[model samples]
Target: MFAFVMRRLAVAIPTLLLLIVFSFILMHLAPGGPFSLERELPPQVLANLNAKYGLDDPLWLQIWNYLTGIVLHFDFGPSFVYPDRSVNDLIAAGFPVTLTYGTLRARFKTR
Candidate 1:
């Protein structure tokens, strides 16, 4: 049982890391960013905002920082539009609802 669990964990860790990397790539490749605005901001303001969010860093550095942040802090960082809330907060709030729905779905499907 111990060896089985360890093997599963070995696979799970790389799978999760790959998932994060793919998500990061897709997010960055998307047309607009979390900070996109319909109206243009001044150049200085835009640059400042990018720097503030570490968007000015090289892509590799950004990816490294993002992975390290999650590993060390278990944080998904703040919401893009909703600056007041973190991703973890949203997940916690929604988990109960999702859990109930999933349980119901599975229960009905097994019938």
Candidate 2:
């Protein structure tokens, strides 16, 4: 049983790394953090906000930091669009919703 689990883990490691790389690229490309859309913050304040989040870090360091953050602390950092929730929690909710897709929708659909 341990061997089987280990074998799958071996395969999954690379897949997870790929996902991290893709996620880092996509998140960095977006305009700003969850607070970015706030009308209250002035332009200069927004620039400071980005820097505080390490948005200006080199791509490799950013990706490495992101990957390590999850493995070491089980965090994917905060939500870029929902400051109140962690990225890990948001991602966790999405999987079951997506996995059960039509079954969930069909139950509430009217004829």
* Top of the candidates by lDDT: 1
> Native-vs-model 1 lDDT?
0.89
Candidate with maximal TM-score = 1
**What clash count does candidate 2 reach?**
0
lDDT of 1 by residue, 60-102 (tens): 9999998998999998877767778988999999999999999
Superposition error at 103 for model 1 (Å)? 3.0
Backbone clashes, each candidate: 0, 0
Can you give the TM-score per candidate against the true fold?
0.83, 0.62
lDDT of 2 by residue, 64-84 (tens): 888889889888887767768
How well does candidate 1 match the true structure in TM-score terms? 0.83
Q: Which residue pairs show backbone clashes in model 2?
A: none
After superposition, candidate 2 runs with Cα above 4 Å error: 29-41, 89-111
